[model samples]
Target: MHNKTKLLIFASLLLAACSTDPMQEIPNRGDSAPEIETSDKICNTSDDAVAGSLIVKFGEEAIPSLEQNALNAAKTRSALTRSGIESVDDILNDLHVTSLERVFPEAGEHEARTRAAGLHRWYVLGFASEEDLDKAAERLADVAEISKVQFRTRLYRASDCKTYPFQATANGQTRALVTADFNDPNLFWQWHYINNADQAVATTSVAGADINVADAWKLTAGNPEVIVAIVDEGVKYTHPDLAANMWINPNPSPEYKNQDIHGWNFAADGPISWGQKGDSGHGTHVAGTVAAVNNNGIGVCGVAGGTGKGDGVRLMSCQIFSGDLTGDALVSSRAVKYAADHGASILQCSWGIKAGIYTSDNMFIKQSPMDYEALQYFAAQKNCEALDGGLIIFSAGNESTAMSGYPAGYRDYISVTSFSPDYLPANYTNYGSGCNIAAPGGETSGLSGGEKAGVLSTLCSETSNGADYGYMQGTSMACPHVSGVAALGLSYALEKGKRYSLDEFKTMLLTSVNEIDSRLGEGSKATIADVSIYRGKMGTGITDAYQLLMQIEGTPCLRVALGEVQLIPLTQHFGQGAEDLTYTDIQMSAKDMEKLGIKAAPKMYNGKLMIKCTKPGSAKIKVSAIAGGTKPGTGVVMGGMVITKEFAVIARSAGAANGGWL
Candidate 1:
């Protein structure tokens, strides 16, 4: 039924919407190395082949002793030769060692010492056979000049290997079969989807409430529209609930026309499909919360979280992972660049590989120009290529540790952590100096032993065998909420004709956050120093649509009316027995008074307007009128009257506003 209703909404909007357009996608950051022409075709061609994992590092001592190092290298080469190893790229092209240092010298001294102290080490190429590896290490170990010769193993699953279908396992239920090794913790974290529960109280209140959507509307119903770019598994494009909110990029070019579902798949994983109607449910659930079709009386409501609801902004899907196990930072970076290159204002990432800082164990070494440069290059791209320097929201991870994870720990992005409905941080959420904010991810309250997870809007799985609905919790889930709020801010800016760079938006989000509890710990409490550290840090606090709209345009007055009072300047206050200041019901006789300028009353409590009701239950109220034609010389009457106090005068409404008082 929910799907059907969503389809109906999509139908209506599709009919009224403009047609699809073309796209002129920019190329990846730089050109690739020209393919080597192999006349014999003997070299390995697979990106995941073991030969590709060869790692080597050079030190100042090793560089200066070129002949000695080469002699050591020859001994190692002989061992590899005896073991049937075909290649060794470690030999220097020239023995010319220079006294001048290259690369990070300050850090290099520490790195060199760390190596001597058994911290930063060096490695030669890994081989397919252990016997070969041992032989090579033995040859180098025999050389007196060579201080160390170590052989390490690194796994290489083919980059184009078998694709694993998207699957989710939770609470005794499993959505899809695990074709590959699903039990591996590393593999699981690589593709998992989590939840967001920033406002569990408010979210659950509305989710479980019986009130209709129309009445629940506010000035922010759809105000401050946001555009969230999901860079993960592909969304069910035609999924009834998610179709309408998908962004439709308006321009197309001949080279790449009709790319306007505002979505694209970049994962090497084969045959990507929207986990819909026989698909994986991960992307569907995410889409539902981000901008699922709302108010159709079928499924759940998205956090549209603002007024003016035009299908609640838009969602752009950039698929970097599919059923295939081919996901990597390189691919993810491409998706990031794509989202920015297009009009996607904000990017939401829920996937990443666990990689520590560059060390000897890293596939690439710090001093080596080829591989290490490639890894740091992406971080550079995120900072340089993003549109308007758009913000990227990332999950802090579910590990519950002090160690910062990649991308989330990148510091350049908005790292969000998860909180339960009760406002306590989720036990599973990872935290450290990098975490910027926390949102409700959902868990029961009271019991110290309870899960206390975060919660937010949910969606039906595109892959569900039978469209199911339930709650999920994690920092992964918490990220989209911030993303949605960012979208809302963007929409607000667009609607009000205001401009905000990504930096300014970050400023607004950080400062505007409603600090319910000082859960930031003893040392982490926000202070002047912390604020400065976070200057332009966490994007403006959770977006406040009402505040944004009001800031954009001064308050617009509606109609003002006074009940049963005529012929004097209205003085409203308690005359002994009357209700306190708020009881007065002042209605506007005409909304048109907004156009004609007259005397504007005090909105704040400083002065200008006063409320005085005579002596009690007599309950008599008086009102006076002044129009544009009132003579300039007329004396303003400051009239006061006293009557018998009887019953109290309760304020039904409040002020008469600016124009005229009736």
Candidate 2:
């Protein structure tokens, strides 16, 4: 053949290889639109059809060239209207228009998004069909003010409605059931965390011999004044053991009569809703795990069992799931926001779904990898990143694959896979990503020598028509073990006179895990302090209650005075320091103090130093070595230190001695 003919043949072959054929690609889109599988059952209504319109986004390719362009354009409303564009929102939403974001030229600091004209402006437009996409592009071509048009696809998800048996409310008021009888040996062994007197009080269970509940017991047993929010399906706030620990939300919505819906109802249904007759009981069970009133000699004991000595970790339910919790991202996001805004340092989402469960079909692993997109969103929203420090712990999942579910997939999150003392990932548990870490989620019926991972916890059994605690398996059972440990960690951090961001807290939790010996290899371990220390299992060696408590006690408390950042570097010496030692560089400029609403200055009357807190909550205390290092010029804010003794008296009385000024 001639050279030209051979070249033509090669060209033809390349074209054929690049042909749009469904039989060739790994994930063939075929002739149809992209199939974005959502967690919700696709709604087949007219509304859904309307909602199916594609929402596109265009970035820098779609913003104004400069601030001059915006100023030069028609300034009058009529002129803009004539040009077919009214405002920014319209430009962002309308398909016919391409909206451009305008930036000012005289900005002092170059903002990342504002450096380029359209650099960071997100464009969102809707399209009903491919033909509509074409028309939208045509409109963009004709509009000078418009930059570019991009079409984007959105994923939709909803909740799954799985029903378990049990009344949602046990007493129609405050209280929740956290334990049950040991009638069923299988279940009894499973829930050994709940009523197992031997496990609760023993230094360790049969899993290993070194574990003890003393630290968890000490921290919460006396029922210290801590409040933990149980953000889950609405709790049966009326369960007997949980009432005392249930959080009362002082701030509630006007639509509801109760503000402390502390026990709340975020469900779509009402009091007489379909499942109200028998709540799934996941939340009640979880509440029991955190702070079920202990030693009532009735149902069961809690991680922090005290007559009310523990700082009450209030159970504030942000009902995300009715029971099944199918896999609703929007609902979960809203619940997380609610919990964070309402002062929940530790957020517990015990239930979840594996959104990516079928991408690949490896017979051995049997599930898809964790959803990266979903997990990213959760991690990004963690308040500890840019807001206040917080931690979110989720079960590694029960699919038995080497992958965790969404939310848990995010490394910023505490990914908790389950393991038994025998040293094995639960047969039904998920893992991989090496994810965050592993914990004792307990095992199912399958184990070597008939030995299984056993877990004791609160259960809401439908068999009795009311709430009851019991043992269970799966990472679902394993998640709370980690959550309880996280709570303990948070308390430890708080006592250290310091706070950790989400990343810091996650690091602490991961390192805190104890390892056990198992077939999963040397890396497989759970929290230490709970059992006989085993090696190579990946855990920190069982969550050591005593060791952790000692560690907390060892952390030096910062001696911060009111209205100042004083670096009192902790010394080996125990007990409070003498009154004469001064905390240097306190930010107490007249203007700074005044801005904080402090009318009185701490005067050095004779030899005593006195101060007062005029404001409630946490106020600022700035300190700096230099006279003008901080704003209004001077010091770093003294954020730690108890001020109740003096602040309480002043807050109640306008003229209360003002606490002896320095």
Candidate 3:
């Protein structure tokens, strides 16, 4: 039956049968209600509701009737008082009557009304106790005027705060170091930026196996305009390396004007401090990796932190995790919306739903409706003042399985997997086709003598009141690498007056990876075959910062094969005056050809360059073009200007092909 019709029939029945007291007709209920059960699940919130809080959903056409019933029940119960007399005004005063409000209220009434008009069709109804709330629900249950009634619950973070004890001294003495110099003294210890010959300690020959951030830094370190919202635990804005880069809200709402100087703390429902007291510093660590002040002679260098010139990308703390490494899902959803609406270009989330009892084989679980809608809303916030669209990145869970949890598994977001120092998938990182990229999320446990192999960044001691530094390992650490690189890409684009849609930005990030399969063996399996479940499935290889920036520059060098007699096609474009003409402008160094063991000269064949190699080697080939008119003898205008571009050619021998093409 229609809801309105049902409500009318139910109201008529109540009027005809009860006439005097509606509370007396409620079934299966005494003066008090029974307690509900609670669970230990990550987001299961059977016990999270405030003591007297209840969420009641009244049918669209039954709000007035529901209110009248509640008033009548109060009046009927008050009549049974010791005085044996009651008035509607006395009942209202004794019952503490108040208007129903939204469960998750938005910033303004219009926004709240709009959201309520959508999926969230519930209200916050307060009572003196859970019993009162339950009794109200029982009274309304028989009436079709009510759709649903339940206690309000909350969701919290699943990951624990993992801190490394070994990074500190045996005596637990803090190091007193100067941080005013141009370069941080500990810069040499950052292996993810420049792995010195893949050595865990000591700075020697460079391995050049990292994201190649140093080279990209030369082009553009970062711009302050790009804001990356760290949507995890609250960041410690007081940390020196991070304080300079923290984003301050220019026009905060009155409720948060004093507290939200840096960013809003959704968990605490106030300004972004280091969460409630005793909170874990997960968000602070992630923010440091994204844009810690560089060259301040500080502890570490961030991926996109400027050259100590105070020009790094800004950091916003969307604190989802509170005192513990957990928080309410409703609060988290709100934080995401705030980040998207408040001008965050990139959203970095290093936490997600945990796969508690379910193993990798049964990992098809989905996200809640509210959580999914929050992500979708953020994804749709394109054309922000600073960016074309907001990019959402999530950490592939650290479950050591081939399954990723949502929102990482969500198709619209970029999922990042963990790669160890050896450029292999970290043993604990969850991986699958949903993984969009990989970064160095270190493995400190495998090293002997308790070496610090984990990713290093800013940290604050649980006991100490001051800022510090330490190491942490997880897909959490891996996520910010991509976020920072994305900031760099955005910085470059903004510098060059280029605007890319979110799709274009994601395409650039995914396509510009170092091919691990080509470098390592086929499938790019881990060296220890037993734990190689991620073989051929860990996204598009690891992220390459240099390559990504080069692609953004729009002059990427091409690679081709030579020994197989490959044909290289060319599309030549010239000035407006000169059209419909072609010229032969292929150039190759004789020395390079001899060095590469190429016996045949490259010849132009029907608008393509054809080359043959007699032996196995690599060489650089240069291609150039000049414009000419279609009329005879109007050839080679613009003084035969050579638009020289270099391309790489690799010649593989037959013997190598027969074996593996390593």
Candidate 4:
């Protein structure tokens, strides 16, 4: 009944998005021991800890007053009373602790939640750069008041792993005629979102290997209510293509208090900046993939980009990396927390902690608690009214290893692997456990597709070889397609008056995929070595946008085997006793038939429609049948209304076992 206890309980509830990041409980201990090093290695190498800095977590006895005084410059220094200061000072001796500050800022949105999570208990200690980091951490850990000491690890913005700058057309502008969904000149090159199979991303192409978002677009373009945070390089919010869909901070809370009205730039501790030297526009490219303004008639398309209707999912830049700026666990921890506080429902991270360092769950959790805690806080947030919790999506490392990188490999969040137009794993993509779903990440050497094989999107003019938009490839690019599809599913759920819990929504998102293992046996663009190696590594096939929406709407899918002929009974759509009713013919457009790879003109035989498909994808068909009458020209001219119903057909590979009716 106490007010303080009630506040703590409320705070704890916010981080209980689902469960703890740890697999099993860690036994509590306050002593500093040499054998069991708890401050996880911040990096994969021996030089893991920051030279002059150490992160310390104080116990309950020492945090109360420090928390109250952390925001006040003068009081913060004095808050560390004699006892606590003397204990730390005795161990440091000559290597004096220069400055002390809280690791995480004053969380306005969920201050109590941050405290209850023990983030407020964590502090950053700066000392002389010459001291041995491990010795200092051990010394601090010996203090009875300090429960944990962390050597903050620094993270680098790895090479984007992109192919040569590929322009769809001569001037980086598309001359192809604009399509119905978007007028963006370069939408034709975005085969990752909607693949007719004809758009060449590489030498070997599959007709329906994309995310299957074309039909999903008809249901809804995108809802501004959904926001995806790009937690990589700074996004150029002023770019012509991404400007409209950028998340604007109307109220500018502490999270958005920076100058870039679009989203805060943690990399610079100021406004979002994508134009610094060495800026690869990696974040800008990723932002465009997630939710660039569509139908703008200038640049490429976004997966959740509005259908020329100012309704795309909002893009929020949570910049952790800029030109030469490197981010660490402490920096990224704040970035992820800021994303949750500022109304972002999805966290799109194209990078992760060291790859291959953590092979098990326990090891990662023990070594990397800060990143884990921040991610948990982000995932636990309920930023959108239509969704119960948030989704954290990351790229499987491009290290060409068997296991995913840390964070993505952490198992609690979703990790995306890369596939090419041929429906096989990218040569550079990491495969194996921790990889959740696969998306088109493009390749470097598609003999025929050339540079166009890479995923194309808006680029920073600084890095686009003089163009505002360009192309890049990697699991980084693949991750956003999943994020965009998630945004689309949420948008559709909102329009249909539906609400879903985080787990339920994630289930639909992962299951909404086409089978890829079937085709993985044969074709590839970059190398043949990855074909067999990727057999079981790519997660749950391809992320299909249409299937996700269909599941959300409770729409049934009629499955058919690819490259096979089947006679479908008309009674399935009409009544079982269709003989009694006046029957008309079934009609399907040539375009619709082509979408499913159906070749023959639709024909009805003995109340059954016969058709064959050469591709694997989803399409809609229309059928008409009369009621209360024998035939159109027969008796009973005033028959009941002609009962017309539409059915959705999804084709699957007969050789593949994972796909079938929905």
lDDT for model 1: 0.38
Q: Model 1, range 1-662, lDDT digits (tens) per residue?
A: 01222222332333223221111011111245223222211111223323222233322223323323333434454221111111222321111111111111111112222222221222233334322433334433333223333222211110111112223334211113111211222111111111111132223211111101121123333432356778766766566555667777666322133443466665542233655332344555555555655544434455443321354657777776665434443345445544554555667766442323311222223122222222232222222221245677777666555533445665556767654433334455555556666544433333231222223233334344344333455666667656665555555556566675566666665443433232222222111112122222222222222333333333321212223232222233233323222222232222212212123321213211233321111111232222222222235754333232111122111123331111
Could you arrange the candidates by lDDT from highest to lowest?
4, 3, 2, 1
Between candidates 2 and 4, the TM-score winner: 4
TM-score of 3: 0.68
**TM-score comparison, 1 vs 4, better candidate:** 4
**Cα-based RMSD of the predictions, in order?**
19.0, 20.6, 11.3, 6.3
TM-score of each: 0.48, 0.50, 0.68, 0.83
Candidate lDDT scores, in order, read 0.38, 0.40, 0.61, 0.72
Question: What does the lDDT come to for candidate 3?
Answer: 0.61
Clashes of each: 77, 88, 3, 0
User: For model 4, how does the per-residue alpha-carbon lDDT over 1-662 read when each residue is reduced to its tens digit?
Assistant: 01222233333344334222132233233355323343432323226656787776665556534433332433333332222355655765556766666666655556766665666656777778888887777667666567666667776543363425545544222233113466776777776765555445554666566787767888888999999998988988889988889999877653334454777777678888877876788898889999888877787788898876789999999998877877777778878988887889999998877577788777776677667778887888899877899899989888888888878887678889998776677777888888899998887565467667678888887666667876788899899999999999999999989999999998889888876666555433347543666777889878888888888887755656677677777665566875445557667777878767787866566676677887666777766776666555437555455677666777755344433211
Please write out the lDDT profile of model 2 over residues 291-393, one tens digit for every residue: 6665554465555435444354455676755643322333444355445555566667665546353222231111111122222323333332122455677
Worst 10 residues of 3 by lDDT: 171-180
- lDDT-wise, the better of 2 and 4 is 4
Measured with C-alpha atoms, the lDDT of residue 148 in candidate 2 is 29
Q: Top model by lDDT, which number?
A: 4
Candidates 2 and 3 compared: the better one by TM-score is: 3
Q: Candidate 3 at 161: error in angstroms?
A: 3.0
What ranges in model 4 sit over 4 Å off?
1-46, 68-85, 92-94, 156-180, 253-260, 522-526, 559-562, 566-591, 594-610, 614-617, 622-647, 651-662
- State in Å the error of residue 51, model 2: 8.6
